[model samples]
Target: MKKRVITIICFVLIGIVQSNAQVTFQPGVKGGVVFSRLTNFDSDFMTGFYLGGQLAIKFNKLYTLQPELVYSQQGANSNYSDLLIDNYYNESIITVNNSVKHSLDYLCLGAISKFSFGTGFHVIVGPSLDFKVNDNFDKSYFYSDSPIGFDFAIVGGFGFSFPNGLSLDARFKQGVVDIYGNNYNTNIDNNNNGNYDEVVLNQSFQLGLSYSFDIK
Candidate 1:
């Protein structure tokens, strides 16, 4: 599967490079701290890290399209009791400990449109395809079945770049897809309000430092 994906990426990059020879390509590497959690579900944020590389296809000074491949670690810490998981019986109460953690690792493929401001500041917005590489969750927890292996998310961020190729950026990623495959969706009150919405969506904030190398 990785080989197939790499082949497709190579073909796409070649096509893109051949479309315009005058465009500059800069390769960059990044490492970041990630604060992530599942939306609602009485979950708390967990800290992780992400590392990746990207290629900046610069069309001009103001516009550039960046494609990146990153490996990110993220998840949430769930500490709630008396979860009514009526999967087998009419009323089943499962007491989850405070230390139950959902650890997830994802391989993220993304492309963003970067717009530069007055000097070195830039804003980027894009979409990402995240594939779950690993997950550690109890099978008989609040989720009835296994979580989905893929997620679609939108990325929004801002960064400042220096002439020496150093940059600092922050990004917020929100998952649009509900990865929770639970059959019982209307039972729990995650937000402690009167409404009940047990939708499971991944949300994260990332702060990163990067350095780019000019390709000649």
Candidate 2:
């Protein structure tokens, strides 16, 4: 998987290297709603918004390489019950029900390759780098640490374009990095290595609309 990601990046870099030649440029704006959740937990999906811009470099009639910068908000809500825990003073055992809302904000940078087929239908595949800007959860809540700072993910989708430069796409993003890597609370750490024995990843689906302006 790592090797595949490296190969994709190399191809994108090659595209950048070729930009010195003549090409077509299209500047675009995009916005979407994200249905996001944290995997490995029974949590409800959180609906958030994303807004971004993209610059599309057209190499030929059927291909374009687009670079985008986006701001996205994501999170989930979880309700857990029947938990046993020692008191803060380490004196007695107590049962509690915990409900939490995890919220995160990120700045996402992506290089997406767009492949157009017949009749304006197209497919997009890309790699994304997400920088954690802010999150509502802290270390005390996780009993280990906050969520990871940077996340790597793959995004792919299909869309249709209109002659007016309006387009719509639906994409799914799967995180390659775990939100909690080897850090677990006593409730989850059975091996005492702070390992939860499982990985927690970010999964989300996006529906977006974009409009582009042609430039010389």
Candidate 3:
């Protein structure tokens, strides 16, 4: 009986060691383009890219935690509807006459939860926080304030990791908050006097690749 117990204890210890050996602590980088669009906005889709790195810690057979940092682009496009009548004395009417394009850039930080199904396959889901880095706007219209809103988004994706520590991933990010401020009024002033003009939001889809480090 004593001998049998010793054998069992040894087997348990060996199994624990083997289990730990299967896990990896890794760092990786990813980049890809987002085919993006804002729902209900005039512009169809915006193309942009994201580049970033992640620190991954494997906990067990099915789960891992990864924290990431990336530079991402986000925004929307719209057709300018009217030309603003410049004369103050004349009856003011700003007719919606043309189309416009705008863009916003962000430095994003995210946390991802990974669930692995088998060798080299995994699914990742998480949330991201974005800080506005820059903005691009069309020259013709005079928008009084910065149109960028929504400081965060929920992101999710799936991909696989190779034995060499390289990983490939495709992700989707969606805004949880309204990107436009409540003060924005889209009313058209027919008299051409400069007043509140309607504006649209830009949203899009992103597809990309990520490379991870191998831990031995």
Candidate 4:
């Protein structure tokens, strides 16, 4: 299903490019810092980074479409206490303080629309499809479960470009789907009603700089 969707998007974009005789293309590279956290995880945002490349297709002076491929790092850091049984004497109960850091990496494909207001300013809005490339948990005390393989997010931002083609943007991305698998089970009962936790979502803010140049 994901492959089909990607293929369809590609064909549509190709058709648009072919139909527009005066379309201009610009290719660029971008890198940035990401502040990310998991919602409902009782965690704090973790500082990470992203690097990516993009192709911007301009149909006219005021409207543009940009498709980007990015490698993004996102996750959270959490500290909590839990009850544990000693390995040596299985009956003895112990209160353990645990700190865990989860680092999730994704390869994201984003399709963004830019509505230019003035010479160098634009409003950007887009949808991104993300595939998990890696998931890492740095702790021995807590068990780390992998998140769902795919995620969907909505992104919105404001950007500015210099006359020299140096561009900068700040964006917010909010996950619309659960990052955790449906079978995921959590020991923490956040509601205090003796039920396992619900799904968790990803929330992030990104600040990036890019250099753009005309391709054709």
Candidate 5:
């Protein structure tokens, strides 16, 4: 699947290059804050930041292809409880209040297609691939390891560019795949089926500003 995604990306890049002769290339840097949380987990949004650079391939007055490389931080604050067995015949009940902060960092590659309407206003939608760079969690109790290292998300947003080359945008990203292994077994079997029934995913909102300069 990774290979297939890489292949698609390559084809998109090739198409962009082939179409660039009639357009312009603009490069820029952006920085922003991200409000992120884990889905299917009892958690709250964690505030983090992202920094990146992007290349915008303007195909016409109304269409553009923007590709970016970004470093982003994401995670959540969670508090929950678990039941443990103290012995074969004795079950111990304990309440676990987890104040631990999880810090997950990723190097992401994203490609967005932009559609412009009036003036500098536009709508953007795209896909992103996140490669985990690092992660840390407070290990005071039984904590699940960070979700599988690679994540994929669908992104959508709106933005406007000023005549002075400054732009502002807000986007929402939704993970299309489970961050945790799909087959991971949870400790709780509410249905008494003896099988795990929980899954975790990633969701985030990003707000950013950038300055673009034409390169061609």
Candidate 6:
């Protein structure tokens, strides 16, 4: 998967360089803090950040499509009582109490549709695909491991641009796909040696700053 992504990026870059459009294409960096949560598990936000570049293609005076590749961090943390496993019928109370920390990181690819409001301001909305790079379950009350999964999200944001080719953007993104991997027995090893890991699909919100260059 990583190799394929690299190949695609290389091809895109080559094509851009070879194009003969009168429009300008400027690529710049983006980075900002993110707050995320896992549904059905925890409700607290995890602090994360992202840094990436965008390839913007200008179309006339009103709109453009920007494709971005960013390394983003997204996840959540829950208190021991949040799982509500402390009842006799609830098994895994011990495990839930033991799970102290958990997190997920993703490599994301997204496309943003820009509607220029003129005077260097634009509204952006689009879709993103997230590939989990790592998921961690840490703490004593639970198992000593974590699971892997993928995420799908929709993005919307606003920004301001400078006539000199610099821009500032702020966006909010939400996950529309279940982050959960699957369903299985809540019991760890059939014999109930431990508790089965629960996967939660959650929503993420981000406030980001990005710089864009114009190519014409």
Which candidate leads the pack in lDDT?
4
List TM-scores for all candidates, in order: 0.75, 0.74, 0.68, 0.75, 0.75, 0.68
Off by over 4 Å in 2: 1-22, 82-99, 139-144, 183-197
Off by over 4 Å in 3: 1-23, 81-99, 137-143, 148-150, 181-202
- After superposition, candidate 6 runs with Cα above 4 Å error: 1-22, 81-99, 138-145, 183-199, 214-216
| Tens digits of per-residue lDDT for model 6, 129-215 | 888887775443453545456778899988887777677777888876556555444447857654333545656777777776543
Evaluated at residue 112, the lDDT of candidate 5 is 91
Runs off by more than 4 Å, candidate 1: 1-22, 81-97, 139-144, 181-196
Kindly report which residue stretches of model 4 are placed more than 4 angstroms away from their true locations once superposed: 1-19, 81-98, 137-140, 183-197
Model 4 lDDT per residue over 1-216, tens place: 999999999999988878787788999999999999988888999999999999989888788899999999998888889888888876798998877778889999999998887778988999999999988753424645667788999999999988787888999999877776553443435664533355588899999998889655
lDDT per residue for candidate 3 within 120-163, as digits (tens), equals 79898988887778875534255435655446678788888776
Q: Encode model 5's per-residue lDDT on 106-136: one tens digit a residue.
A: 8999999989876889899999999888877
Query: What's the distance in Å from true for residue 171, model 2?
Result: 0.2
TM-score, cand. 3 vs. native: 0.68
Q: Whose TM-score is higher: candidate 3's or candidate 4's? A: 4
Q: For residue 157, give model 1's deviation from the true position in Å.
A: 1.0
Clashing pairs in 2: none
What's the lDDT for residue 181 in model 4? 59
Q: Which of the two candidates, 2 or 6, achieves a greater lDDT against the reference?
A: 2
Candidate 1 clashes between residue pairs 3 or more apart in a chain or in different chains:
none
lDDT of 6 at 53: 84
* Residue range with the least summed lDDT across 10 consecutive positions in model 6: 92-101
Better of 1 and 4 by lDDT: 4
lDDT, model 3: 0.72
Clashing pairs in 4: none
